[model samples]
Target: MRAAGAQRGRVKRARLADVDPSLIRPALAGLVPYEPGKPVEEVQRELGLERVVKLASNEGPYGPFPAALEAIERATLELNRYPDGGAYRLGQALAERYGVRFEEITVCAGADAIIGYLSLATLGPGDEAVTGWPSFPSYVLDPLKVGGTPVRVPLERGRFDLEAILAAVTPRTKLVFIAAPNNPTGTTNTRAELDAYFAAVPPHVLTVLDQAYFEYVDDPDYPDGIAEYAKAGRRVLVLRTFSKIFGLAGLRVGYGVGSEEVVTAIAKVRRAFDVASVGQEAALASLGDHGEIERRRIANREAMALLTQTIRGAGLDFAGPAVGNFLFVEVGDDAETMHGALLRKGVVVRPLGPFGAPDALRITAGTPEEIDFLSKTLSDVVPAFR
Candidate 1:
């Protein structure tokens, strides 16, 4: 019996080695998985520290709005059943809020998930999708996952270079993703730039405007994505998320507004019941809680200002006055080293190595105390790194 088992194990190993890796999609093999914010538990376990501050992943540190808790409690009774795949009520709420038709909306688990649906529905082998680097990685990853070529235009002065992106476009270009108050840098393109960009892009090329931090934006020139949809000619989609200012990052609810055709194509490949029942309910409830949203938004702005001041006082280089609820600070050579030092010190921040900014780190805005802790840790640790 021992000899027979040994023979079976050998045969299994040999058979596995015989399968050609080339059979797998060529783009998928080396693809590194997305890294989310470091969980509190993981850090505590790693460092043997009871106290830690996690300011990564750009998530609002606040809990769900009061009304959202009620919705979650009510939805708890329906856990046995699948969520409404159509997301009728959520769709209706968003449509009414934006003054758009119901057919133009498609609710998904997150804006990142909508990117997945877009990739599955539109991208194909040899197709090209364009986006700015030092920005969201998903825009590049999603296209590659579908065997589409990703054309990354480098940011000019920490912002999207629209002209360069347009110049890079070819007949094979199928999609473009623009993240407003773009991640890492957190700067925005003006309304004039987007208008010019829309005009330059060909009708065959679809554009996705990711407004994940829309509610935090206070800039007068920050173009409204819902309004941008009206200006776009052929193919355009606006993405918004509940993960940021709505303080529902755990629930993973996001939505898109676009042409009926784009919505239809994405829906064709959309994962059914993607958004949870509780997530949908919480999102709907939060939308009506405008007072809470405004309060949180105002609070975030104050916290951001405090952090920016600290960054300046420490003589740290940073992108100025971000519209989003985060700041990008330059930490000199080998960001991973600095990142490790901070991790050891019980403060968590996102190193931008994967985002192509190895000299910098992105920090999500936290409360006054949290920001002060980060600033102090950074001041102490950064000198050692230098």
Candidate 2:
């Protein structure tokens, strides 16, 4: 039996050697892939638990809009037909809503795809891309994939340090990615700060303002990042997604709006017919359902409030004044341990250890019942750790 096991290991190693070593990018050969949240079915199977509430991905607790569902159903019969390569109708819809020309918009499989395309289009072996640490991993990974150095500026007091990011830019800097109402922390920058940062950025470097959670923001002071900065003639690309607020994450639709020149350049790097027909139709339909979208925003606000109150009741420290559909809580213990415990209890939340916050967990706002389950699970598990 021992001899058989050793022979099997040798055969596996030999198979690995047969792979074309050059086909793999040197930078990505050993790099770990992004670890997404565990699927609900997988958790149920692993833990032998029937009831699982997942508040990990910052997805809409209220599912997709009714109109979007109807549109998707309508498009199902046309699956054999190819999606519009230009995404003309979706572009027109976004342009009409934002008061921009259709030529200035480009749709992608998701916002992450746009980020990768932008990095490939602008960044190179000797270039540098600047962004804040603990914002989003893609901002760093995309640049690195293109052989560009990722210059990370530490956030100040849990917020993006605009001045520091501006100071980090040099002749080698090719791109900048700023997440408005940043992920994991759920904080946003003010208009004054953005104005100052925009003014300081050189015209040669492209700036990407990510507004994935923009619709959930109710704060008047939360800088209208795209509308304000892009209109001011800055070389900025504004990225928005249907995945979050519209509840079309499964469909994978996102769009980028910017100057015609910037959009055109990024479009060159996009794969052919990348955006699917159903994704385009769903996003278009979602735009017409203003009432439903507003209700989702209200639901998110109430859920966040409940989460905040629960966190305080548990005697935990949490970052708030969030404009997004999630809150970051400091568990004051190893986040991985808490995440594991919650998983065992049929509740799943994101651990922020990968984002450099080992003591924090990013909790998405879910339905009231789901949120209650999360709170109760945490209440039971936290004290034991203490």
Candidate 3:
């Protein structure tokens, strides 16, 4: 009996040894997984700290709008059943808000999830997707996940170079991702630049405008992607999120607006019930309160101003003309060192190593009290690095 058991164990070992990595997609080779900002709870646990202010992720410093919280609380009771796979109510609300047809909208887990749907629906082996470097990693990542080539156009002055993006386009290019009010840098492409982009870019390529931070944008020249694209009547998908200004980052609700055909294609590849019931409810509630949206937008602008002032007072170099809820500060060669020091002090900011800027930090505009704490922490820490 012992000999028989030994033989069986050997057989199992042999089977395990025979497993090949090639069984998985070849595209995953050397792909580093996306690293989100460290959570507040995590820092608290690791360091045994009582208070940790997380300004790492570009989430709103405030909680979900009061109405949204009420919606979420009420919706929790309905969690025993699966979510509405179609996300009908939220879709209708977004369609009405954007002035687009219901068929033109597709809801997702988050705006980032839409990128996957686009990649699955459009990209194939050897197909090219063009995007700006250091903008959003998902723009580059999703294409690579589907065995597609990613053409990375370097940003000119921390902003998307529309001409360079146009130059990068080839006949093989199938998708283009433009992050308006781009992450990390918080810079936006102007109306004139986009008009030039749309006019010149070929119709065969699908342009995805990721407006994740659209609600917080106060710049007069910042183009409304949906309105502009609709006027052009081209292959365009404009993505928006409830995560930023709506303060529903935990719920992961986002929607995309495009032509019926484009939205249909993206929806076809999406998972059923990709968004949660509570998330849909909260998002729906968020849209109903337009006044709250404006108030939060105004608050975010003031917080961003305070953050800018704090950074300037510290005598640090930074990138600007930023209209989003964050600032990109140059922290010298030892950015990792500075990042660690700040983390120890219970203040969290995004270090841009994976975003390809190893010498900088992306600091979100946190609440006034949080910002004050961060300011004091930076004063203590920056002198050492400087």
Q: What would the per-residue lDDT of candidate 1 be over residues 190-236, giving only the tens digit for each residue?
A: 99999889887888888999999999987888888787654344368
Off by over 4 Å in 3: 1-19
Question: Model 1 RMSD to the real structure?
Answer: 4.8
Q: What Cα-based lDDT does every candidate model obtain?
A: 0.88, 0.86, 0.89
What digit string (tens of lDDT, one per residue) describes model 2 on residues 63-125?
A: 678888899999999999999998999999889988889999989999988998889888888
Each candidate's number of clashing pairs is 0, 0, 0
**lDDT per residue as tens, model 3, 158-274:** 999989999999999999899898888888899899888999999888899989999898788888888878635867899999999999999999999988887888889999889
Q: Estimate each model's TM-score.
A: 0.93, 0.94, 0.94
Name the regions of candidate 2 deviating beyond 4 angstroms: 1-17
Candidate 2 C-alpha RMSD relative to the actual structure:
3.3
Clashing pairs for model 2 are none
Clashing pairs in 1: none
Stretches of candidate 1 exceeding 4 Å from the true structure: 1-23, 231-234
Top lDDT model = 3
Instruction: Give the C-alpha lDDT of model 2.
Output: 0.86
